[model samples]
Target: MSYRSWCLALGLCLINGPLLAIERAWPITEGMDVVGELSHAEAAYEDTLIDVARRHQVGFEAIRRANPEVNTWIPGEGTRILLPHKFILPDARRQDIVVNLPEMRLYYFPRDESRVMSYPVSIGRMDWGTPVGTLDVIEKRENPSWTPPDSVRKAYAERGEELPRVVPPGPDNPMGDYAIRLSRPSYLIHGTNWSTGIGMRSTHGCIRMDNDDIGELYSRVSLGTSVNIVNQPIKVGWRKGLLYLEAHPPLEELEDDAKGMDEAVAKVMDAVGERDARVDWSRVRSALNEVSGVPQVVGWEADQPLTTSTSATSSARAEPPAADP
Candidate 1:
């Protein structure tokens, strides 16, 4: 949809009123979570930032934030881009919530001693990228109500379709079955009538998850917990003395400029603060450049080799031995 249309339709969801306030997202941590090797430089044809990130398992936001110079339309061929592949796991401390922008995923870690559970989520579009800052879940409601903001209602009225001031819970309700209020005024992590949008950039600014996923998360998380939103993909891991790396593409919206293998590797390493981990820069560069999805160990001592595993679920788990660096 056009930017104007989006603004009109979802303006209420972005209202800035003095109501329940959710905490802002946290800052990016300079840690690593060992993904796998980076490829060397590669070329792109008919590539969008989102597709490139998906191909490389990176978040669109991380790739976009990393390379601000590359335009979305003309990310020239052999551009030698870096990918945020292996990244440090987000700091989901007590009541600390984390959102990995690159992976398009949200994780809820309870404050006390509750085991954390994560779910895939679709965030805002580039025009309305989800805001990042320290935030918290402020309120919760079952069978909640949705009150379309004034701006949204005005826009619709201009279109000759005046909508209701408030919507009750039902299948047609945009807020879905359950809603968790945020500290950021009107924003929320709630269910959606558009379940397909989960894991895709379709929301205005709120985080969207599958109905089941949200339900599961709702049961586990409570109000007053911390929420952290980040965009690190390529994470570095150190097992014993071996430095390991994993490279994935950014999220859908941030992959528009994903080219230049050397630069991409450097960006990923920089995200994790492990530029010195590259034993063979050339090999690492090549892997970042490669377009294939297969995992590869670009550089390491011949005897002190590294093991790599690539799977969405494997990476999602609390710990996976196969991914040890």
Candidate 2:
């Protein structure tokens, strides 16, 4: 079956019931800047944002950002929620691993494979910010041991809880099952025992993924794979000749920085390079103000003024462009 047909089928199955812990991959067509369709799932009586996010292969922050009004802890039954499955590929080299700090997502482009896989990630907290730069995966390990750093141990001691120097691989280990060490000192992309932190700014300094996601990633990626970390809160890209913009809340530390928005807009413009298009500044401003992670059509070069079918009552509705034959 074609990629588009497969996506439609998958969407149908996903909404009907629970999903397996499998990563979703999208075909990489030539010159396409976006992939996947925006989708929604109804909240059952026992559903929370975290539950829905895990089921849909999205991060908590992404889901919350898309549906700001929904209660994170207990969104009552029948509440319409946005899945945020739609994305504009981050403005970076589409090779190996690309982790966008603001979006709380990691993308992997396998060598010679015509597809990309994405997963939600938990990055470092504001004080112990994750660095931004290109690095290589220096090592890979399974059932990794965790040794709490001096600072972490000191903090735990202040709370009257002593930590062991080396934590063995088990249920108690924070570094769950697998790890991919980056060239940057003391930082790793690894699994987490506490999966609730998978889509938020709660980690100390390393990247955290769900146990299943890290296992799949560890199996696919080899040592020396390039890992590029970037902080882009506003992303713009083209799909079927229409320009789409996706905005995420800026990191707390960078919110007050004078050069933040200017630099972000510059990056968006750079990604839309050389494509003749006129941007709808009004829509752009609205998207910026709301900071919704869902992709919105911000401009077009053709004659018809762009309009979206999405409504306030149903924000997750998507108008994916028809697939290439």
Per-residue lDDT tens digits for candidate 1, residues 143-188, read 8888987866786799999789999889888878888878996678
The candidate that wins on lDDT is: 2
* Model 1 C-alpha lDDT versus the unseen true structure: 0.55
> All candidates' lDDT scores?
0.55, 0.79
lDDT of 2 by residue, 1-325 (tens): 9653464455321232465454378998877888888877788776666677777777878888888999875678999988888889998889999999999999999999989999999999998899889999999999999988899899889999999999999999999999999998589999998776678888888999999899999999998999999988888887787778888888888776424345545655665566555555556667877888888876665443545522122222122222326
Which parts of model 1 are misplaced by more than 4 Å? 1-88, 91-95, 112-116, 154-161, 238-325
Query: Where is the poorest 10-residue window by lDDT in model 1?
Result: 311-320
Model 1 sits at a Cα RMSD from the real structure of 13.2
How far is 233's C-alpha from truth in model 2 (Å)? 0.9
TM-score of 2: 0.85
- Collision count for each candidate, in order: 71, 0
